[model samples]
Target: MFLLDRPTLGATWGSTSADESRVDGFYLGTYTPDKRQIVLRDSSLVTIPDAWIEHAWSAQLTLLLKDTKRRAEGHYFNIPIPRQPGSESAYFIELADPDEPVMYYTVPAGWQAEFDALPATVTVAVKEKKQGSDSWEDAITIDTIKFSRAF
Candidate 1:
């Protein structure tokens, strides 16, 4: 996540501060699904290192709402298929193919039948919280995200 911040400015947690210039502090992390663990690294991009310990998956949810309104219908199970170990290079090569379709996740043999029978859509509720606010605004209904075979 990118936060508008500078090294000299000081602000409390959940507090808001305004800065004139463009200075962003970002944290990068990777999740190990098989271990159900996330490993975060201190990035050299920013002088002041920041740590994020809350729901790491929230970023994906936030991105899913990026193109749509505050709320949209999403798949109940939108897990991405993980690539096999040592296949990273080949995966990137395949993704470079213009005609190749993108896939969300791979289904194991045991879940293939059940996965195919699953419903196509689900309602996704979204709300916004202003800086330093303890409460979240009421959920709002807006345009739903488009899901196609590529999803």
Candidate 2:
């Protein structure tokens, strides 16, 4: 079983002579076994770090699970961060297997728009860790996906 703490939503604004634009911000904190108290960490990169131009738009904690004896491969799941303003809400998820590895990732979902607006082929960074290995190899170029426009 996995538990998710309340997510946080932040925003950045850009202003010009005629218009103002809002960019969403996402930040995630830690989780606990019980729901009584949620602890916010000071060393969190998303919360303590500051940028002059960019910030987190949305954040969520994802817990991946699989049967160790039956499944040979792992899966990726994207949990959408709630658009709430405070860190009071909590989410819970239960998996069939408890021995599955627990991994934490801080992916900025709000940045998807910038990637979607790119033209044609896009170069992406890939990293992988071999089974039974303790360390992940350095990032390598693997594949590229091309987008088609129907105009």
Candidate 3:
């Protein structure tokens, strides 16, 4: 029972508001099973029943930012991935790198609407913790990854 199967490619500008502040890359999905959860290579992992297994894939999004301001200060950026409907019952692993290919599930039991309602495109922004700053600030708008899958 495979659910999602497709290749992804995207690139966007960083929050630096500079020409050099940009991130771009592409990746493929690969299915791998495990005792605990389904792992997508070095990117992400999902915990679901073996029967719910439809298809699995992995890919990576390489990031490149010119504003070494935060990295130089020992800080890294965060790429947020919104939770899908019914995700509360499912375990989702977030990878540190934005380029890492993640695993998505297609369960006909109860996730049809969630999958159908999925956004056609998702925006991945870059945030950094500045020195002397208590919280993170938006640096730049990364790529708007357009998703295309057949439910």
Candidate 4:
């Protein structure tokens, strides 16, 4: 998941202070095998380059759940890709499905090298850890995305 950088798209959840830049909506994104490359959903397909990793690896988005109490709340979203899929990977040990409205994540710095080593194709396992649970339940397996980086 990635945050769309449009402030006018949603209601303000936090102060508009310059120190706290915020995003509006969350766009479903695909993490291809290409290192630091992410395909984001917007008016059309937008491929963010590795250079963006330096500045946009983390962001704040407003929660837009139907629940009035939680809606419009600010949440921090970060990139925390696993070294590999499966529970053995520390990145897979996260709390819940951040793709959910209650966004929660921690950015792991210095993952560029690991990302660059990823194969040209990979399967991602989608899992969710419900509240009060100690284990993750496999929800589904995302289909693989293959693209040619050959120029």
List TM-score per model, in order. 0.19, 0.21, 0.18, 0.21
lDDT of each: 0.21, 0.23, 0.25, 0.29
Q: Residue-wise lDDT of candidate 2 within 1-151, one digit each (tens)?
A: 6453443312212211111112222111211111222222222111111111111122232344321111111222222222224532222222213343342332342112121122222222212223223334332222222222211
Model 1: ten consecutive residues of lowest lDDT: 13-22
Clashes by residue pair, model 1: 81-104, 81-105, 81-106
TM-score of 2: 0.21
Better candidate number, 3 or 4, judged by TM-score? 4
Candidate 3 residues 1-151, lDDT tens each? Answer: 5433323322121121111122311111211223333333223554432111111112333354222222111111212233335534222232224653342322323211111122323222222223223332323232122222222
Off by over 4 Å in 3: 1-116, 137-151
Off by over 4 Å in 4: 1-118, 130-134, 137-151
Please, what are the lDDT tens digits per residue for candidate 4 over residues 64-136?
A: 6232212243322223343333333222322222433332233332122112222232222223233323344
RMSD of candidates 1 onward, in order = 22.4, 22.8, 20.5, 16.3
TM-score of model 1 (CA atoms): 0.19
